[model samples]
Target: MTLRRRILILATAVVLLGAVGVFAVLRASSRAAEKDRAQDGGPRVTRGEVALAPGDGGRRIVFRNMAWGPHRDELATVAADVPEGPRTASGVNCLRFHSAAGTGICLRADRGGVAESHRAVVLDAHLEERSSHPLAGIPTRARVSPGGRLAAWTVFVGGDSYAGTNFSTRTSILDLRTGRLDASLEDFAIRKDGKEYRNADVNFWGVTFAADERTFYATLATDGKTHLVRGDVVERTVTTLRENLECPSLSPDGTRLVFKKRVPGLPAEAPWRLFALDLASMRETPLAEERSVDDQVVWSDDRTVVYSLPGDFGADLYALPADGGGVPKRLMPSALAPAFLD
Candidate 1:
């Protein structure tokens, strides 16, 4: 064969092999995705992560004399058999906590419904007296606002009834410095079909303020359905944006919102990775769709979003870059509610 013709044939063969290699890479990636889905068992949870400052010599939220492991899930759940805690997770010293009052360690019950409650007993960053917060009443859900200005406050207005979940509840801006409640006069109400529905069925759990601090978004749960609802902190009106989303978290800059989407193939309790939504054009996109990622989302800066997923074979904390790159890194066996302690 002529030398030039031989080179031409060789180049053609190389091209053909490159095409096959590309096809193989794509096929392998697809297979790996399928395998991940199988291993995860379902959709993952949307999550955000923040780093905490080693305040006062590595001070952390400490839970009371309770088991702090997987075994404790069913155990503490039993204690609140008829109860709840902060939907957001917190570490020891702070431990994870929630109260119907939203800020204190107490229980609030809706009328004619079962009485359920859980309190977090722990010291503050200053290590002063033991503090009380009510938002931790719900266990799997315990979260404090990114800004300390607004806090979940559960209180009974007139009758002996107290606030909990969706019952006439409002947020209190707690002055961690003065130990007083700062009130947010803005309107934070949810209306559906020209009516007001109150109860856990319409509970708002995922509540985070805007970067401008003018608005916030929360997740509303009704029966088994969940929706992402936005509230105009300045206007006091609630807008239902998306549905089937359980926990909605706002990015630091407030231009985007992250949440979890439910896929039909898995159980509701199955984890859901983070999703993002554009506020301007109202565009929605899936950022990271990991399985087994039960979320406790807190933004780390704007580009770097961190969240918690079950790790170490269901015994550790996993942190991933929100933008999606690299395998998740394990921080600790149980590092939750990780927020920038700055």
Candidate 2:
């Protein structure tokens, strides 16, 4: 072919590709704008004062609002007894969130630049930002100690998804009182099978703090196996308690744990079954969900556990008996990462 003709054909292809790209961008923008509008039959949400500290409101549940509207993704609260009631939105937005006592850890994205960045914001009782730390990647799980003195979060530093084996995670813990930050839990000593263990592929996530401010539990992945590890803030050590457990949330009473177990014979996409572990007996009781749950559950009380499942808008909260009996019940629609303040 002639050089002039070849140049003309290349230029034509470039123009067509540019036009398609612009069309895709416009279409995505339109879809995203729709999320800002309230859908019919959606839960009612209004801007109001939300306190992490328990007072006046008696008992309430604070969660990341997944309902579509102007207040979507903000931290919102409702009476614990009436979870499906009208919500009071707190203007604070978080991709992953958890709170305890009067402290909250909000993992949110900073989209001000060309590339999106994430940060963990330490929030007070009034949902005010106390401090913020830049995150290395996409935020996933977040938790604050029961006494509000410590906070921890896990982010997928590199990976397509947490369910895949090739993913990497960075779990960090911050001490509110001392202003100390452990950027990665990998720095802590690990004890497996009653011996010191070390591996380059160790990753930690899904931290759940115990009543004692110094003790915490988390999922530690190493050597292609996941284990429930008990960590000590002061000792700087983590001891593996059991294998094949991931994303453990310690019970309020500190006697048991609600976690996702990789049950055999399940589909790869949904391999987890919610199970309750008795810390004393090392016993695992499978809950009655009969479906896979990928969340790190939160104990609504000492007897019941709450978790998120995929919903129409984003995710929905559901409650189940911690004893592995009874049926799963939807707690709230369009909600994720719930924390009960009493």
**Quick one: best TM-score, which candidate?**
2
Task: Note the residue pairs that clash in candidate 2.
Answer: none
TM-score of each: 0.53, 0.88
Residue lDDT tens for model 1, 183-301: 32223466654566554434455566664444667766566567777776545666777677755767767787767766666654574556677778877776644564556465655
What is the total number of backbone clashes in candidate 1? 54
Ten-residue stretch with the least lDDT total in model 1: 74-83
Candidate 2 lDDT over 1-342, as tens digits, reads: 999999999999999999999999999977755554458566678788988998986899999998888899999999999999888888899999999889999999999989999999999988899999999999999999889999999999888576788799999999999999999999999999999999999999999898889999999999889999999999999999899999998988899999999988998888999998899999889899988999999988899999999999989999999998999999999999999999
Stretches of candidate 1 above 4 Å error? 1-92, 97-117, 120-124, 129-131, 134-136, 153-188, 192-200, 233-236, 268-271, 311-315, 324-326
Output candidate 2 Cα RMSD: 14.0
| The candidate that achieves the highest lDDT relative to the unseen native structure | 2
TM-score of 2: 0.88
Per-residue lDDT value at 68 in model 2: 82
